[model samples]
Target chain A: MKIAETDPFSFKEMRKALFFLTFALMVLGTWMTFFYAPTEVVMGHVQRIFYFHMGTVWAATVAFTVVFVASIYYLVKETAKWDTLAYCSAEIGMLLLTLTIITGSIWAKPVWGTWWTWDPQLTTTFILWVLYAVYLLLRSGAGGRGKKARYSAIFAIVAFVDLPVVYISARIKRGISPVVFGPGGGGIDPAMMQTLLVVLLGFTLLFILLLRERIRIMNMETALYTRGR
Target chain B: MKAKLKFIVPLVIIAFLISWLVFAGVRDSMVYYITVEELLEDVPDVYGQKVRVSGTVVHGSIKNELDESLQFTMADGKEKIDVEYDGVIPDIFTDGVEAVVEGSISTDNIFVADLLLAKCPTKYESDEARYQRKKG
Candidate 1:
């Protein structure tokens, strides 16, 4: 495992393979969403944005979950690799979450007739975004490497408590956000669901590819800094 | 393994406490966006609590009262409520359209709303679609 982490040959080859896979899947998913999926009877072409919107959200959730787990593992093992994993995942999670919010706002303007609302789902997601953004700032501002890792791990765990709340907010009866999944709800067209699933898979692959590259970049930066010092 | 378990137990307890706190927070802050019928069915004691209710604006029941205030009757096909709001209404708010009003019910059986929101009806033609239709 250490060899795999530090050795350049196999890791670089793996990243290369993931890069191609991510690219291919992304193109195919986008094409499927626009061409294969039927136009929604309600929102028309704007409704097609749901695929990308949901894809990024799910991808962000996956990244955050990794952050949470890696944080916990880092706390237990006190390993730099685990800390690096948590940091990279959090960075990627924040990027995907930003996309999710942007796409959600765009979708809301046409369907909800408003670009923003303080509904439970939206509010919680916004809070999570802020929390993660602060986490990144805290890590960067902390001077020592050990202090940065420890503080960031704690923040990652604390911020993750909102994940379940955000996921279920739309399903709550009082939640004004649209419920895409519930009893008597989430009855999506089969083709639309297929497109969403494909896009989600593509996004997940893209996330993995990005995470690997980020971790590699961070490792190089740390080595360079240490040598400079 | 033993050392890890020692840390894990306390973390698990802390996580449990945090989850409970979240549940309580959500329950306290939740304000259901219910229809007029649901609001009517709710106990009268709930009148003063902050809540959100939704219904179709009764045709011709809207009056722009003094100081940008509105007095309107909204119905859910079964029940209706008189709503008094003091604010700029949403652009999509109109007669027969569904609107969600947030605030509380007053003792006088009027919904005192602080915020108003409306979503465009789903079946309506989008702007792009309308433009395409005109060009065709």
Candidate 2:
């Protein structure tokens, strides 16, 4: 299967489609964040950051998942294309997740008294951030493809272990366990749940388009480099 | 797939368990922001509870009492908030810079601050003063 589009007809169409999806989701997410959700009966307008925070986080999670799956595929298939996808997604995921964490910190400053908490999700993500950063650093400095892919794959396998922990903690806290800091603790209000679902779906669609574009650009660069050689 | 799952499944399960608690902590007792009027309306119901209050520092309201506790009133719109902070205040803590106080209200109508943060003045204030001069 083609890793990226080459057809003239599909190229323009896909670009247009991706662009529209990204902007539409951004606009809808912005609007709902500003006007739809109640102004947090206490925090006033600043609370709107929650929607943006969640949207970016939703996109980052999906991108990281792609990175994980692509790492596995590249290892098994020995295809550079899979490697390229993993690299691109990892980079973009880094950018988006970094933005998400920063914005979340800013939002927390106004409400949570401090810029950060050693809460599980935040702590786990910080660990994941450092782990992936080292993975990329190794990829750039590593000597050979065989070793590079192997080490990165092993790192990916270990790094992503945090994902399940994050997911399970959120779920267990809300559903069965009466824990203090659980996800959707006691579940979300109906309106918040609906709004969040819309935002999550929209962000996921936008992320897919972004991943496609990144992969396309990455493939083009690879082709150009090979031709030059 | 099987080999991969062997490592992934157990790790995922443990993370899932911890994450549930994380979600609860973040979602359950999220701190709230309010003005003085709102906090008073709720009284001792909010005593010893966590909250954030935003308002202006009343020019003459500050009193650094004998016990080294600082007390001041903050106003937002039609409401004025009174706060007692024992800790050292932020550097910018002065008259009329919009500030946010964190912590809880005491039963005695004093907003006991655990932390205090003041907003930096926007550069546009000089521009507004210039415009007023041109008009007046």
Candidate 3:
């Protein structure tokens, strides 16, 4: 509790401003997804889900990347703060990834005619989910600090190796998943592209907000434990 | 540093091994689907063996049977195969869309598919102008 008062990184005003900014962006993103973006010609209104699907996946990608970076920093600096950052980001990443999978499955049922399939992209994504879920389980069970944090950080770093594979699997290999962006992608309409960008930006801001809040709570817990000692 | 390596070395090796196993396993048997050409190349071997094949639906090759069965020709540019499916067809299924069918090839060379999945278009477009034109 004392650390919460004296913590140099406690930018209360900045966090408040971020909360309003994320809220406004999310409102705008939702509006654009439903009202501003035109109905997809082929998939009809069902394609509206694309905005949310992209948003969750984008945020999840950022979350996992944060975990990977924080884990490396924790290892290098041997700091509890960095480990806490890694753990918090991983937890958020896992939640966002689960949302991504759920939204994708909902969209898939009508578009792909199946709830799930083990396509290359889906397979890698499922593996990524499993790997991170295991990381969370391991971290929770490992307990304490020092050696436990070190092991968990190592696991996080190792788990990150699957992220890129999940990204490129659809492109390099055969899969039912569509390639919508980059290199061989078929691209989207200009208006749809604009809407997607707004949603992506909103999700990114939401992710930062969640990460900051989670890290703040975690730091407080650490401070309380240290004080009790 | 030596103490760190004592733990890090085994961790790295274990990670490498797990990754290798996953990628290798996927490569060997976990491919989402084979191409029409690949399926055709293994004709006799693939016959009656359930497999999934992906290809673009040949334009104007779709036929709807009265029994709710559907028939279409799928092409991978290099090879084309006849596909007969009886299932809930996906909404996006139409001419020029990519589709994956899971079933076994019959002795007469038709793919009898029990599961059919249509890939949504990679390029998303709004035909608002066309819709307006039609309305006008």
Candidate 4:
């Protein structure tokens, strides 16, 4: 549970700095999206939704990739820190995944002319959301820490397996979902791509900040529980 | 260490097998998009292949063949393909609307689509622009 040799004030200052940076970067990303990024010839201003939509998915991918690796390490090493890291990442990944689905759906209404479809990409993403949500529920709505951690670690691995499938679902078989990368590459403009990369970097910072804060809280709670026991 | 090794070996093998099966299954079922040009280049070659062809609906080429069946010409500037569909046409389906039809070309060179999807016009104009257009 010992996070640093530095004093409590230093930790507080670091958190404040991260919070300010994350907020400032997010605002800057938004400004660039609306003004700097040219309106897409095909989708127009509505295409602006693409920045946040893809950004959240990129960040969620980072978080879940960590969950997959950490869960395996936890199983082998039986370390509490690995399990905590997996759980924290899964929580943040799930929140961002929800945002991805919601924003994608909003953009879909004007672009695809439908609010939702059972397209492979959409379906696989939904399944992932359910899987991670169950991971969280199993952790809290069940037995002791040992049992819950073991169960959730296995669940995290199973859930991570779906990530690749969700990514390639649009390319697989006859589906209406657009492909951002592949043979055709969807013909994205260079300016739009630049904005997307900027937003993605901003969201990545936000993800790291959120994961650190969540893990600190979890470690404190674990410390309290062990002391009480 | 011996017991841990025993547990680890089977887990790795099982994971490998499962991933292989998933990748193979997904590859077999993968449906990809193609342009009108691509579809025409190999009508016989692509015939019966489960495929999606996207293009703009040719202006005035739409003909309501019956209660459910409709015929239209889909063009992507370079080429055009005849598409026949018997499904609930999307509200956005109209002349010049961008569309992607999911099905395959028949031996007769008609794109028999089971699902017809009309891409909506990108909503980008500001309120002022829209109002000026409307007023004009």
Each model's backbone clash number? 0, 18, 0, 5
Write model 4 residue lDDT over B1-136, tens digit each, in one string.
Answer: 6876686677667666766776677667644467999888876778799887889999999999647589999999999989999877765578898898889998988899987877654343434545676899
TM-score versus the correct structure, for each prediction: 0.78, 0.60, 0.89, 0.75
Ranking by TM-score: 3, 1, 4, 2
List, residue by residue over A1-229, the lDDT tens digit for candidate 1: 9977777668577778788889999999999989988777556688888889989999999999999999999988898999999999999999999999999888777565568877788888998899899989988793887878887887788889889988776666365566655573546666777888889999999999899889989999999999999
- Please, what are the lDDT tens digits per residue for candidate 2 over residues B24-124? 55456543356677877777688889976778898988888998888888988687878888775655567776777779877777777888766433221
Lowest-scoring 10 consecutive residues by lDDT in candidate 1 chain A? A178-187
Model 3: residues >4 Å from true position, as ranges? A1-10, A226-229, B1-29, B129-136
Which ten residues in a row are the worst by lDDT in model 4 chain A? Answer: A1-10
lDDT values of the candidates?
Answer: 0.82, 0.68, 0.90, 0.81
Candidate 3 accuracy as TM-score: 0.89
Which is the winner by DockQ between candidate 3 and candidate 4? 3
What DockQ does every candidate get? Answer: 0.19, 0.04, 0.61, 0.19
Candidate 2 stretches with Cα past 4 Å from truth are A1-9, A168-184, B1-136
Predicted candidate 2 versus true structure: per-residue lDDT over A1-229, tens digit per residue: 3644555457777779778877887788667766665544334466567667777877888888988888778766767887878878888778778878898788666544457654455665786688778877877884766778766765765576666555554343211111222443333334555567778878888777878888888789768978999
What would the per-residue lDDT of candidate 1 be over residues B1-111, giving only the tens digit for each residue? Answer: 898788678777887788779767876766557788888888597779998788889999999966879889999999999999887666556788777888998888899
Give the C-alpha miss distance for residue B19 in model 4, angstroms. Answer: 2.6
In Å, residue B91's CA in model 4 sits off its true spot by: 9.2
Q: For candidate 4, write residues A127-209 as lDDT tens digits.
A: 88988888888877847777788767776776677889887776654466766655854455566667777898899999999
User: Which DockQ-derived CAPRI band holds candidate 4?
Assistant: incorrect
| Model 2 interface DockQ | 0.04
DockQ head-to-head 2 vs 4, winner:
4
**Could you give candidate 3's per-residue lDDT for residues A1-229 as a string of tens digits?**
9988877557886787899999999999999999999999989999999999999999999999999889878877888889889999999999999999999999999999999998889989998999999989888884568888888899898888788878877887878899989888978878888999999999999999999899889888878988999
